[model samples]
Target: MPFTFEPLPIAVAALTFLLAGFVKGVIGLGLPTVAMGLLGAVMEPAQAASLLIVPSLVTNVWQLATGPRFGVLARRLWLMMVGVVVGTLAGTGFMQGGHAEQAATALGVALVAYAVLGLTAIRFAVPPRAEWWLGPVIGVVTGLVTAATGVFVIPAVPYLGALGLTKDELIQALGLSFTVSTVALAAALAGGGTFEAGTAGASALALAPALIGMTMGGWVRGRVSEQMFRRCFFLGLLALGAHLASRTLI
Candidate 1:
């Protein structure tokens, strides 16, 4: 139908997705985090988030499928997932309304905080007994953050990390959590009217480049130093977040 973005911006969006996918491939996360942080610099945060929907859904679904413990994790994390849906639904109005700019600014702040925390050695753990009470709380907060910022990490990621899961189990749990978040965020955006046909088409187009980048990154993962690469990635995110946050100020 009608073109929503010029050729130059489209190219930029494609490249941004590619880069974000590469980061995800290498780190097993950060697709939306990196994509939103970089794309929000060039476009409205809502549009940037909309562009992420398809790729995030596709990749995270793939991630969820590849994990053998999906059934087990799903049973354990259902409440948190439900909370994420409810929270995202509740916050969609503000994200789609006059507070869009404020939401973007909040997203930027979140990015900065996440990057800073990631760069540090800080860690947290959730005792098994606390999951019933704390899981939903964290999920709802994560969902609100996801709705407002289009990034679904923060407390969710840390909370999962605290679950004391094995490396593989942790990865599976993350995949499950992110898949749920992506679906819920898509629903919220649709309800908010931020995800239209044009944006959906653009999001579909971005999937190719993102997948290619992920393939490339997977190849590089075994060859390079993950810790070093992660440090650099967080630093870059910190800078991007600062830029986005500055936009609201200036």
Candidate 2:
């Protein structure tokens, strides 16, 4: 089926993608979750997810390329990557028959949960005993959501953040996640026959807007204070969660 482009929706999508990528560029994560959650109200979840893969890859790669601790990030996250792969598979399978709205609702809840953790200072420190399981859990959750809806990074963020990684490490982890999940999702879409040439071309064309957003966000990063950004980030996540929940529930 040919994708009939209405100018309004495409313009809206491009703008939203730009804002979402900007946030990701500045903060190191939240692009897919924010973008897909918001976009799902207007487009099919699969399409939204597919549309983001290219832009997400670009920003994430740039972030990772600048990281100084690739060796440490790789060692630390090797196990977690396993979990992400599994989660991606499960999510993909689940999405094959699942409702997009349900996934959006779930994504909203997950973001709210993270925001709450940030607000309340609640920490789930991975113990040595449970450390072995953390990777798989992240992987499974990420995979399930990635496959089913394309917005699975929110849950993984707090856990990764808790690793006490420096800003650079965090950037590396986000990059790795974007690369792995993007590839997995693309493969899943191909296997499912949803990967279309025209869609891919459109996604590529839309990359410029996302890049522009990232550039603006980076410029703002130094001028703004960390505390200020944290305030806006959590509040934004909360608002986003509320919007998604309301959309899905109503």
- Superposed on all Cα atoms, the candidates' RMSDs to the truth, in angstroms, are 3.1, 2.3
Q: Which lDDT tens digits does candidate 2 get at residues 41-69?
A: 67776777777777877777776777788
What is the Cα-based lDDT of residue 85 in candidate 2? 74
Q: How accurate is candidate 1 locally (lDDT)?
A: 0.78
- The prediction achieving the highest TM-score against the true structure is 2
* Number of backbone clashes in candidate 1: 1
lDDT of each candidate versus the true structure: 0.78, 0.71
Residue 197, candidate 1: alpha-carbon lDDT? 91
lDDT score at residue 178, model 2, on the 0-100 scale: 73
TM-score attained by model 2: 0.88
Give a tens-digit lDDT track for model 1, residues 109-168.
876887788699975677788899899998899888888778787668767767877655
What is the total number of backbone clashes in candidate 2? Answer: 11
Worst 10 residues of 1 by lDDT: 221-230
